[model samples]
Target: MATYSEEDYLMLSGIQHFAFCRRQWALAHIENQWNDNYLTIAGQNLHHKTDDPYISETRGEKFIVRAMPVHSREYGLTGVCDVVEFKKDNNGTQVFGKSGKYVPIPIEYKHGKEKTNHSDELQLLGEAVCLEEMLFCHIDYGYLYYGKTRHRKKIEFTLALRQELNQTVLEMHSYWQRKYTPRVKPSQKCKSCSLRDICLPELLNRESVNEYIERRLSE
Candidate 1:
């Protein structure tokens, strides 16, 4: 049997939650459990919409959408992008007729409306980080194409977001190094989590406290 390294432990999307909530990241990635609800299913289906290969012409620019596999060894993350658009840059003229270059814009499709936080932004930013490292270029912005609003919202990859992304990568590495699974910290988000059944946070908490009391009595 082949042994999986700690580098193989990180999930690309997990970095998002690790930034939002460390416990949530550990629950999903470390525990190996997930429970899919209607929202998650709908979001997944939205991604499927862009999974196929297709090209579109818009205002003299060609947009090629592809489901590309992306990975970053530096961040220890790997995942697939829903749609990556390549636009030709005709500004610099030197090598090949105004030098057409590839500018990668990763579009993430979500099922629900935008949230009042940076969770979604962080996720997209993580993808941008991976793309930047892979492409060796500055990706200034990307779009979050939402199904609910039926529009594409431009996201500026700010310095703060980049900092958060770096912090998330470091924390995920630390969490993945731990041998024991973390205790569940349940919240309303858990209701939407697919791992609720397997996690059994409420039950686990009760059992843990009971065992602690029993051990004290025995002592």
Candidate 2:
């Protein structure tokens, strides 16, 4: 398997943006454009609540780690997981300095309720891939904790999901290599996009004055 050097690694968080929209990913990652909308601000605040790296707590058989750094050389990705819960299990791998074997379950905190899109799920899976690589263990499941609903949704890390994640990372690296920003395709989702004004999806949708004049001349 191929491995990426530290300099070549991309942000694992970009998986969510890439899954949401390629143009969005290019704008933020390539063009370095970002805007703070209410949704984004709230999301940031929610992350702030859990982004502390020094906190680790033990609850019964579970050891909870916050803001754990993880990376996967195979995917060329690195990021901080919001939470990694190590549940004690006889079948799990032994954690260093811990008494028993435990399963590493990544838990991501989302600001909103569950959406129809797979962006959040893909992001969580990316984190799982990193943990699996860093810990040298197989992770079969993860969780997404939503602030809006105050609920945790479990996700299965299946073979198909793993394949999709690998493909997504490959595409991300290709785009990064080319430094490409894809053209805008306007949609309802644009309304909620943080970089909507900078992306100008609405302007891209409308015909330019020059184009209108050209069409009139042609007519």
Candidate 3:
């Protein structure tokens, strides 16, 4: 399908989790399972601080919008952007109530520092692509703000990255359609995963931690 209806659109944020671990994504998104570890709680707090739909400000040439809703029908994805800074530019497009044309730059906030994996980049690119579809503009890059290190890192949306994103989203859609959840392949990353206990990689079955506990108690 060239495009998906709004109803078919999947959660755009799930790409990050899917990239980190497909099982993690399936558990949280498909199985409706989740747990709040320190990292997740911290990330939620950071998102809360940054995501306020009512908050919009004009800073000279920059118009800042918090919790901007964005989507891409082509990718069948939807999510809220933490911050979308519209900077005044002659080559940019016009805003609804604003006077001048502006280019949108998306900034994502994470509780932890930069990771060795490309999960963060994949998620950021998903947002950028969604914005491109919504704004009808080309965004060469965006920003990733690390909550732990308190630093902002620039992320370029390269041709290779876009290709990778396309593949990732397609895989996600296929899995979603089948309601498929893959078995866990244990790794060091599991140690810090928020859903580690729920996943119970050691068992590598459909059973959940609570279910296992209850069954053991009866036995």
| Residue 51 lDDT, candidate 3, scale 0-100 | 99
lDDT of 2 by residue, 131-191 (tens): 8877778889999999999999999988888888888889999999998777666888988
The models' CA-based lDDT, in order, is 0.69, 0.88, 0.91
lDDT score, candidate 3, position 169:
97
Q: After superposition, how far is residue 180 of candidate 1 from its true place, in Å?
A: 4.7
Off by over 4 Å in 2: 202-219
- Superpose all Cα atoms of candidate 2 onto the true structure and report the RMSD in Å to 1 decimal: 5.4
lDDT of 3 by residue, 1-219 (tens): 599888778897899999999999998998888999999999999999999999899898998999988999999999999999999998888888889789999999999999998899999999999988888888888999999999999999999999999999999999999988887679999999999878888776657555677898999
Q: Which lDDT value does model 3 have at 163? A: 96
Q: Which number leads on lDDT?
A: 3
Top-TM-score candidate index: 3
Every model's TM-score: 0.78, 0.90, 0.93
Shift of residue 55 alpha carbon in model 1, Å: 6.6
Q: lDDT score of model 2?
A: 0.88
- Of 1 and 3, which scores higher on TM-score? 3
**Model 3 ranges with Cα > 4 A deviation:** 205-219
Q: Which pairs, if any, clash in model 2? A: none
